[model samples]
Target: MDFRFQSASPASWADVAADALVVVVTSQTQRKLEGALATLLKEAVAQGDFEFKAGRTLYMHRAAGVKAVRLVWVAAADESPKAARAAFAAAFGALKQGGTRHVAVAAAWEAGWQPAQAEALAAAAAEAAYVYRHTKPSAPKPAAWTKITVLGEKAEAKGVQEGLTRGAAISAGVTFARELANRPGNHCTPTVLAEEARALAEEYGLKVEVLDRKAVEKLGMGAFLAVARGSEEPLRFIVLRYDGAPRSKAPIVLVGKGITFDTGGISIKPAAEMDEMKFDMGGAASVLGTFRAIAELKPKLNLVGLIPACENMPDGKAVKPGDVVTSLSGQTIEILNTDAEGRLILCDALTYAERFKPAAVIDIATLTGACVIALGHHRSGLFSPDDELAAALQASGDKALDPCWRMPLDEEYDEALKSNFADVANVGGRAAGSVTAAMFLRKFTGKYRWAHLDIAGSAWKGGPAKGATGRPVPLLTHYLLDTAAAPSRA
Candidate 1:
């Protein structure tokens, strides 16, 4: 969908041509409404038909005074960007299944209203309208929702326009990630993922390199290759570079764990919901998603993405429990359980990131169920020894409304990975599983400033709303933008 800003008076809202005119309401909303719309809202308030409570909504079809086919009034918690996002999303979601093709959104015009509010609205609308139909041949056709016009003062066009552009890009990235992650294991294998990366490279002029098994083997990625042995599908070590800045500048490196379908190998999970394991590559999806957005924005900073894509299945050739493998960092790992495969691939990828001489390295993975238990579905688990890096990520997550809860990464947690045979153990028992997983990856990241995002829960929902959340993409994008806008480091 496309979004733009236009000047429209409150009285003129009655004459606007649209399928739906969404009026955003805050605590001070009543006083801002004008003409027939004001009278309509006042009557609704007096008759107890509507209130300015958050999430409360009122929908009218061809209301007596409005030219639009429908009018949607949604109450935001406040004028804040986050609230606006949720409220706008709710409004659009109400119309997603309907015939509403064009929407006109108007909020109280304030002198100091940040464009972030407009950005929030654009993102929320796009996300709400997204419907997956790639593999569903019998599924209904895509929604006709096309253009979104934000009613604003003419003086505020430039800033709001920029925000809308960014929001659209972010939403597109989120949608792309969701589509890739939503695909079944058979449709979205490691090789298919590499093809998708190449497609993105062609479209955006990015530098993409997909390493086959032989290439990965040549690179000495035993930990990564071990995970691919169980599946018939080939493994791909995909690398993406966005040269927005000069080669003289060091780039931020993103490492993603791409377990296409995890059957737990020798240690299989319960059969009840093993199908959900297709989402094990949520991290890889987010990496690709963030790349999609940054490549579009072309922020003034170089960035690189690494995805160790494969499947974890049970086979005669599969790496078994108690198997020891050498990582790209030359460190040996004792695989206590084949189920702990995300870290195995990620360890090798983290080591590869060191070659970039990166400003910072962040590895995202659905590495631990413990994280789901710890943070629930609300926040991703963030673990970092570097306070500055962790703080920056935390701030970015907050700004993007994709929050992360920082976990402990003290030396005490590292002790859990003690191995009797190898240098480190793959599984750190049951206690503090998330932290131990981070600690295991930290072994390979010692060469650079690194952080870890354990997106076990935040990656996707499990029950009724089972789909990829396209997290960390927003957080990572915000972090990149902030990093670019920040003063150059000496």
Candidate 2:
């Protein structure tokens, strides 16, 4: 989708045309407004009988307010455009419910609020208005909404506009990741996932490095390689780097579990929707999508993404229960259940990332079904050793509206993975299953401040598949941007 922004004077708003219409107005009751669009709206209200309730959207035969653009109301505050856009979206969403297709917004001018900020609010509202449209074969086409005009003053609002643009672009990237997650195993394989990553790299400015099966073997990624033995297709480890910050900036590292399809190897999964294994690589797609956004935003932060892409098929060569494998970090892992494949691949990748001496490391994965059972679909499970790092991520997620809930990473969870044959066991019984999985990955993180995001429930579309919901891309982007904007240890 393409986005465009235009700047025009208040009088030019009347000529602004669109399919759906939103007329900015003062309060529905008799109240003289004294904010940004005060003069223009005061004059327009006296000239006509237009009714605008706080939460209601009214259609206009002629453009109302100073700009003559479709208008929404901000009660009194001069810097109330953000609130006004919210009102506009509420009314506009209602119009869509009422069968309206397109919407044009006209706003009353504000002296206090920067136009850029107002535009950002407008873009945010529009982006939030997004509804997944991939499912429902008979669903109606979405109505077109193209233009938004703010009335009154025309000061430079470049900063606000840039923010809104960044948010919307990052949202688009998240949706891309979700789409990959929603695909069926038959349609999305490790090979295919690599292709998708390459495409994204080409479109953005990120650098891509892919290590094939032989290369992975040479690197001694035995645990990851063991999991890949089940699939006929060769495996590939994808590494992406985006450095927009000064060369001196410490690079932040992101790792993802790219199990494109998981049939549980020798420990076969239940028959029900095993096909949905296509989404197993949702974590990899997410970080890749995030890199796309970071490339565009050009934040002054050094970053690297590690994705170990493979399929967990149940073939003769597949690693079976009781198998022991060594990781790139020189740690041995006992395979208690072949189904626990995500961590196997991710452990090696995390060990690999330690070479960069990253300022911080974050790994995302659909690692355990137990996570879904624990958090349901409401939130992703966050596990981190560093409190400050966890707090920053949680705060960033909250601001981006992609919330995360912290999961414990006490030594108790680590003990669960204790293995008689190896340093650790891949599966840690049914109790605290998610935490144990996180613990297994922690062994490879070394001294880096690491956080694990188990996106089992958040990675795909649960309710309906109108399109991919793109769960945590925005949250991850928000976190990265925050870190890039301000340096923090751990």
Which numbered prediction scores highest in lDDT against the true structure? Answer: 1
Q: Give the count of colliding residue pairs in each prediction.
A: 0, 19
Task: Give a tens-digit lDDT track for model 2, residues 134-217.
Answer: 444575655454444333334444644554567556756775776677666666777877888788788886788889998999
lDDT of each: 0.89, 0.73
TM-score versus the correct structure, for each prediction: 0.98, 0.81
- For model 1, residues 41-151, the per-residue Cα lDDT tens digits are 889889999888988888989898899999998998888888888898888877877888899998864442357887798788877777778788886656668999988
Highest TM-score scorer:
1
lDDT of 1: 0.89
lDDT of model 1, residue 392? 91
* RMSD values, in order shown: 1.4, 5.1
